[model samples]
Target: MIDFNKEVDRLGTYCTQWDYVEDRFGKKNLLPFTISDMDLEYPDEVAQVLQQRLDHRVLGYSRWKHDDFRNSIKNWYSKRFNCNIDSEWIYYSPSVMYSISKLIEIFSKDGDGVLLNTPAYNAFYDVLRTNNRKVIKSPLKNENGHYSIDFEDFKEKCKESKLFILCNPHNPTGRVWTEEELIKMINICKEYDVKIISDDIHMDIVYGSRMTPILKVAEDYLDSIYICTSPSKSFNIPALTGSYVIIPEAKTRDRFENIVRYRDFVNSPAILSVLATMTCYNDCEYWIEELLNHLENNLKYTISYLEEYLPQLKLKMPQGCYFAWIDFSELNIPGEQFQKMLIDIGEVAIMNGHVYGEECEFYLRLNVACSRDKLIDGLDRLKKTIDYIKL
Candidate 1:
């Protein structure tokens, strides 16, 4: 046993996931399992690399020489997924959300519809709506504890839609979509001429055997597929940032590059973050695998606890990510109330599923990336809260 719990207390000195977000809920203290950010410390090697970079001391403009960034990314992808990536496909910017918003502006004219599958990451809703763009949702099929995309609905949306935002290893639902699913999805987008901006930020955290980056599956059809990925999720360092978009064609790539240039957000990150990103990808495999194992075990423990103590609380163990989308619909309460009840009474602050989409009422998403003990404590608090409420 890796004792992932004490490690959190030891390392989470300034953890935003654990220490921050108190203000969001207006609480004096909070046990927040609401965030997607993990409470784990970086691997010692990554820490060492950053320290070494800092020792060099002058914070100045940094540029990538040769294939440093791409090579690190390529090596990580190959080792993790056996998927070969290229330096040519690499294009970067600071924000994936910013990049996605830019594409919404590019592909869709004013008031055009952009397709999203719900429940999705809460960020997408703001990203679409704040730009005065319209959001059209074709809800995921949630039958018998499994979530699947409604292909017909997706295709239908394509006729009226100009852009498709894909959350691979999807958030909230935690389905690490199969290649067959990705292939059919690609074909539908191709058939309907709906351009795809696939978000694979959770690409490296899958609980399953594989996660097919949309581009890796849609290789021949790459001109239409825009894949966004980052070391953020894998290394738990979104703040120290940059993300790359893989566009297969020169024209599509150039258009994005031009847009990024216009926005003035296109530039290589400083050595501090870029150096950590490079090292995290190139090294740190064992720690990542170990972390995944811990998360998988955490998910298993959560499921088992629910079955034994709270069987009415239903959730399928997600095939990817540490997010547990537990359906508390049987309680017949609004998801927000349930989340608040958990926080106010149970003292466990979790994300309300309603934030994901309209269909997610009466549900909550718990991030289980903390130590096993913290997860167990959260589950215990949840069990007591529900049991008391029911009584």
Candidate 2:
């Protein structure tokens, strides 16, 4: 039984969430409910595999195309989602973002419009901007706390866009896309000749919500679909730097391999990341199950806490991902002021929503993947910030 409440000290390890809060928040030692990485420990099996590889000490250029790597991923998808993944469809990348950026470059030209649902993963914005592509927004409708895509708007955007970037089990607002929702988006993109890039990095961690992998629904439309995902988010191993893309079309896969090998010169996988992936995918199923239960409890606590105390702050329990996207619009506080107050007055570091997109100005994304004790402290600080505002 994995102890999800175990508090692992990460402050001195050059950790981004704890040690480097000052970099983004401009303050040190602030309790951070920021950064997507978990405060929870990963499975011991991952560490054991990594240690076994480190004991060999060769550290040479490592290939990721072996049966061990491919079979582990294939079996995981089969067991977890009941989705069959072909070994040939899996190709390695250093990270999910890298694969998405490369696919954007491969499929679209500069100044070409890329359709994205607004209030997306903030990094998607960075990827589009850095690549010189036009960001065309099809904002999701927020009715009360529930979020759903506006297909009419999505269809209109797809007509003019060259590619559509999707965040399955979407970040900030964790709406796990239903099969019906995904099929609609896939068909719209197909009609417009728009290529699809589904970032399913947060595929795990779903709470009772079914995670319909875009590949599952895109059987006939495989040529236009690319699924970029990683075990990094699931296993808390982002530092290991391993991710992959699932491209069913042989010609498209070859084109992407050329970009990764020749253009990026990313010939070898990170040895430790490969080993960690294999171990976690093959051996850590129970760990994920336990983590999800913990997250669900944390999420329920968050929803109950807000309802009882800070009823003004609206939060809908997210269907997937361990993030609580709380609407601060009812507070009527300006986004900039609210963020500053959280940092300076409450001494807490929570992500302000405006960075995601212009539509999310009055929201905040809180990381709930922490020990329950730490989550309580963060919530208390948030309450303090609200109290100060009310006074």
Judging by TM-score against the true structure, name the best candidate: 2
Tens-digit per-residue lDDT, 233-258, candidate 1: 87787777777777778887778878
**lDDT (0-100) at residue 144 of candidate 1?**
75
Candidate 2 lDDT, 134-193, residue by residue in tens: 999999999988999999999999988999999988998999999999999988888889
RMSD of each: 1.9, 0.9
Off by over 4 Å in 1: 1-3, 10-15
Candidate 2, pairs of clashing residues: none
Candidate 2: residue 163 lDDT (0-100):
94
Can you give the TM-score per candidate against the true fold? 0.95, 0.99
- How does each model score on lDDT? 0.82, 0.92
Off by more than 4 A, model 2: none
